[model samples]
Target: MSSLLDVEVKETIDQKTFLTFDLDKETFAVEVEKVVEIQELTNITPIPNAPKHMAGVQNLRGKILPLIDTKVKFGLDPIKETVDTCIVVIEMEVEGEKTLVGTLVDAVQEVVTVPSAEIQSSPSIDAKFDLDFVSGMFKKGDKFIMLLNLDKTFALDEGDAADNKENQSHAKSKKS
Candidate 1:
């Protein structure tokens, strides 16, 4: 048999396992290592000056993190009070730094381990929702769990990003 050592074969891929959650009828997931904790649905303090998708702030063990509605981010209908809603707190790394961010979902399913071999780059999805936030897709059993690139999902535009950078820098200085 002829040897086949192509570039794709020579390169190794880095994959992190993730936990799946449901929104509307679709299933999705984010890196498990990035996830801090999944909290039950609770009162979130609305922020008067926050962005449209931001549900508001929440205090977890004395640490504050912005709670973002996945429905809002995906342009879904407004969420009504339900028994299954929850907040999946994820720690994301953006621009070479890490911070905690919580995402509200319709319901959270059990965690499913996805192997690196099972992941593939996602293609252009229909424009109904922004697909740029999706890093890839992984299949387990008969389900497809869209892997969210949290960094890209939380990517802020110039002004807001600049404000975040300033805040981060100040925080860094205080720490040092």
Candidate 2:
């Protein structure tokens, strides 16, 4: 699979690789360029001082990689992961460098090709989950799959996480 050199910042492309998956009974698609590799659920090594959304790191073919639980990022209750859960390894171009990140999906459906014309801009969403993370919506049959901006979804940096922890800790300390 070839990495689309500029999918992170630019959204003006025609054909796109859609990796569809189920999230809370809804289907979502992340650009295929964002996906490094899809693998069956594997053991994750927890890292201290890591972001809360971070599920931990996993070893894929001897590579240590970070795993982010999308549920946590979206402010939803964490789903009890089962054997069916698989990690979708994503490689994103962040700040001019390609970084690898993984998100655990309930189940991966398939990789389908959809032209850019079929993707429609995000409509106003009234949920706590940020709609900006969604690039567009694609319809298949009576169902619609939200095409996700994986890079934007899992794009938190260490500095941002540290600042968040500081704020959280300050808020906690004041509660005492």
Candidate 3:
């Protein structure tokens, strides 16, 4: 029988680095190359007429960056900020434009190198998350980490007038 370390080494020969983070106690990873930086929770200014999943925008350096609540995007409960909460800055192509966005995660975990052979295709099932966003899955010890296809996962489309109006109204209510 092959030892666990041997199996990992064999599988990790052609590995790619990924930055792992926690969301609702689940571990998810994104390619390290796509990640710009990781920051602690910062004040987010609400935006009018934005989508529900949009947490708002924040000033990163001098540039404004749109923030997405990963929990809300996944249809999970909003995160209660703690010391571990962080914002993961990522760059991706959105609507043919390169965009920098911050993703709110429960906690930022360590960077891991996962081998291509270790990744398995995501199963199509009645999962809480849209399986389309999952590129693959791999095991780290006994825990499985879902690899996210950032482009597909963070794709945001222009909203219709009614939806924009509704979001605008919701934002107004929150300010009161």
Among these predicted structures, which one has the highest lDDT? Answer: 3
Q: Per-residue lDDT tens digits of candidate 3, residues 1-176?
A: 99999987876667889999999989999999899999988889987677777889999999999998888878788888999999999999876888899999999999998667888998888988877779999999999899998876687644434556787788789999
The residue ranges of model 3 lying beyond 4 angstroms of the native Cα positions read: 1-13, 158-165, 168-176
Question: Could you give the C-alpha RMSD of every candidate to the true structure, in order shown?
Answer: 8.6, 7.3, 5.1
Question: What C-alpha lDDT values do all the predictions have?
Answer: 0.77, 0.79, 0.87
lDDT of the structure predicted as candidate 2: 0.79
- Poorest 10 consecutive residues by lDDT, candidate 2: 6-15
TM-score of every candidate relative to the true structure: 0.77, 0.79, 0.83
Q: What is the lDDT of residue 161 in candidate 1?
A: 54
Residues 1-176 of candidate 1: C-alpha lDDT, one tens digit per residue: 43466544544334456789988788888878888898888879987545557788988889788888877777787566588998999887767888888889888887766558779888886855578778889887888778887876776656455655666677788889
For candidate 1, what is the lDDT?
0.77
RMSD of 1: 8.6
lDDT computed for candidate 3: 0.87
The best-first sequence of candidates by TM-score reads 3, 2, 1
Reference-based lDDT, residue 166, model 3: 86
lDDT of 2 by residue, 1-176 (tens): 44677664355456688889987778899877677788877778877656667788987678778888887777676656877788888888888988788888888999988767888988896955678678789888799999887667878866547956876787788889
